[model samples]
Target chain A: EAGVTQSPTHLIKTRGQQATLRCSPISGHTSVYWYQQALGLGLQFLLWYDEGEERNRGNFPPRFSGRQFPNYSSELNVNALELEDSALYLCASSSRLGYEQFFGPGTRLTVL
Target chain B: QQQVKQSPQSLIVQKGGISIINCAYENTAFDYFPWYQQFPGKGPALLIAIRPDVSEKKEGRFTISFNKSAKQFSLHIMDSQPGDSATYFCAARWGGTSYGKLTFGQGTILTVHP
Candidate 1:
C-alpha cells in the first residue's frame, strides 16, 4: 500500500500572501493530520480532520486552517502568511481514530 | 501538560552497538507512545509503538520500553548499523479530547559510525 503523499514538495511565497498545501492519505485511511516543523523547533500539531470534519486543532492562529475531503485527503491553507510560517508542513494518515500515523514527505513552505 | 521531553539531542553510536533514546511525558492521560525515524528531507516513519498496558514491545532490532509508573518510555535499537543513522522522534497521544493528535518531542539525531 502506498503511504501518505503530499504535493508541491517546495513552495515559496511572500509575506501577506496565501499558501495552500495538499495531502493525500493512504488508501483505506480515514484520518488526516497536519504538523509544522520549524528549524530548531519540534513538530507542532496543526490540525486534525476525520470523516470530512475538523476534529481538533493546535494553538496556531486562525489564519492556519484546513479541511478534509470526503476521500480523506486534506488541504492546509495559510492566509496572510508570515515569515515565521516558513517551515516544513507535514501530513499524516491513520486507518482509525487513535492508530499509528503514517507521514508523507511533507511540503516545504518558504515565506519571505 | 502535553509536552513530551526527549533527551540526548544527538547520539553517536558505533556500528553493532546499542542506541537508546529516552522520552518523558507529563500527561498521564496519554496512553499511546510511538517512536519515528526520519531521514534527511523525508517525513518521519513509525518505528515502533506501545500502549500503556505493555511494559515492553520489541520488533526485529527495535524495542520500546515503557515505564507507566514513571510516565516515561524509551526506544532501543540493538545492533545499530550505519543506515540506522537518522533523527528519531517520540510522540504521545491521549484519549480524551484530541482524537489521536500527537504531541512530539524534540528529535534526537543518531549517528552510527561504521
Candidate 2:
C-alpha cells in the first residue's frame, strides 16, 4: 500500500504571500493531520481533519488552516506568510482515531 | 507550555554501544507514548511505542522504557550504528485521541561513530 504522499517537495514564497500544500492519505484512511517542523521548534500540530470535519487544532495562528476532502485528501493553506512561517509542513493519515499515523515526505516552505 | 520535555538535545556514541534518550511529560492524561526517527530532509517514522500499561517494550535493538508514576519514558538503541544517525522525537497522546494529536518534545540528534 502506498503511504501518505505530499506535493511540492519544496516551496518558496515571498513574505505576505500565500502558500498551499497538498497531501493524499493512504487508501481507506479517514483522518488527516498537519504539522509544522520548524528549526529547533520540534513538531507542532497544526490541524486535524477527520470524516470531512474539522475535529481539532493546535496552537498555531489563524493564518494556518486546512481541510479534508470527501476523498480524504488534505490541503494546508497559509495566508500572509511570514518568515517564521517557513518550515517543513508534514501530513499524516490514519484509519481511525488513536491509531498510528503514517507521514508524508513534507513540503519545505521557504519565506523570504 | 511544553508539556513534554526531552533531554540532551544531541548525543554521540560509538558503533556497538547503546544510545539512550529521555523524555518527561507533565500531563497525567497522556496514555500513549511513541518515538519517531527522522533522517535529513524526510518526515519522521514511528520507531517504537508503548502504552502506559507496559513498563517496557523491546523490539530487536530498539526498546521503550516507561515509568508511569514518574511520567517519564525513554528510548534505547542497542548496537548503535552509523546509519542510525538522525533526529529522534518523543511524543505523547491521551486515551482515544488519534496519534496525530501528539505532543512532541524537542528532538534529540543522535550520531553514532563507526
Candidate 3:
C-alpha cells in the first residue's frame, strides 16, 4: 500500500508571508497528523484531525493551523511565517486513534 | 507536561557490533511506544514498537526493552551494519491522543562504520 504522501516537496517563503502544506493519508486511513521537524530538533506534534473534525493540537501558536477534508487529506497553514518556521513539515496517517502511524516523505519549508 | 527524553545525542559503532539508544518518559497514560528511523532527507518510518504491558519486544535484530518502574525504554540494534546509520527517534502517546500526535524525543543520530 502507498504510504502517506505530501505535496510541494520543497517550499520557499519569505518572512511575514503565508505557506500552505498539503498531505494525503494512506488509503482507508481516517486520522491525519501534522508535525514540525526543525533541523536538528526532533519532530513536534502540530495538529490532529479525524473524520473531518479537529481532534487535538500541539503547543504551537495560533498562527499555525490546519484542517482535514472529507477525504481524509490534510492541510497545514502557517501564517505570518517567520524564519523560525523553516523546517520539514511531516504528515502521517493511521487507520484508528491509537494505531501505527505511517509518515509521508515530508515537505521542506524554507522561510527567509 | 508529557515528555520523552532520549540520550546520547549521537553514537558511533563499528559494523557487526551492538548499538543501543535509551529513552525515558514522564508517564502520560499509555497505549503505544514506538521507535522511528529516518535518513537525512526522508521522514521517519516505524522501526518497532511495544506496549507498556510487555517488558520487551523484538523484531529481526532490533529489540526494545521497557522498564515500567523506571519509566525508561531502550532500543538495541544487534549486529549493527553501516546501512543502519541514521537518526532514530523514540516516541510515546497517551490514550486520549491520536496515533501520530506523539511526544517525541530529541532523537539520536547513530553512525555505524564498516
Q: Give the number of the best model, judged by lDDT.
A: 1
Q: Please report, as a residue range, the 10-residue window in candidate 1 chain B with the lowest summed lDDT.
A: B93-102
Model 3 C-alpha lDDT per residue in residues A28-74, reported as the tens digit of each score: 99999999999766788899899998888988999999999989999
Model 1: per-residue Cα lDDT over A4-71, one tens digit each = 99999999999999999999999999999999999988899999998998989998999999999888
Instruction: Using TM-score, rank the candidates from best to worst.
Output: 1, 2, 3
The parts of candidate 1 lying over 4 Å away from their true place are none
Q: Put down candidate 3 lDDT per residue, B12-103, tens digits, no spaces.
A: 99999999999998865766899999998999999999999999999999999999889999999999999999999999976753435688
Please tell me which model should have the higher DockQ, number 2 or number 3: 3
Report the lDDT tens digits of candidate 1 across residue range B24-63: 9988878799999999999999999999999999999999
List runs of model 3 lying over 4 Å from the truth: B97-100
Looking at model 2, the pairs that clash are: A98-B98
Whose lDDT is higher: candidate 1's or candidate 3's? Answer: 1
On TM-score, who's better, 1 or 3?
A: 1
True contacts kept of each: 0.89, 0.68, 0.79
**lDDT, candidate 2, A1-112, per-residue tens:** 8999999999999999999999999999999999999997889989999999988899888989888899999999999999999899999888876558778999999999
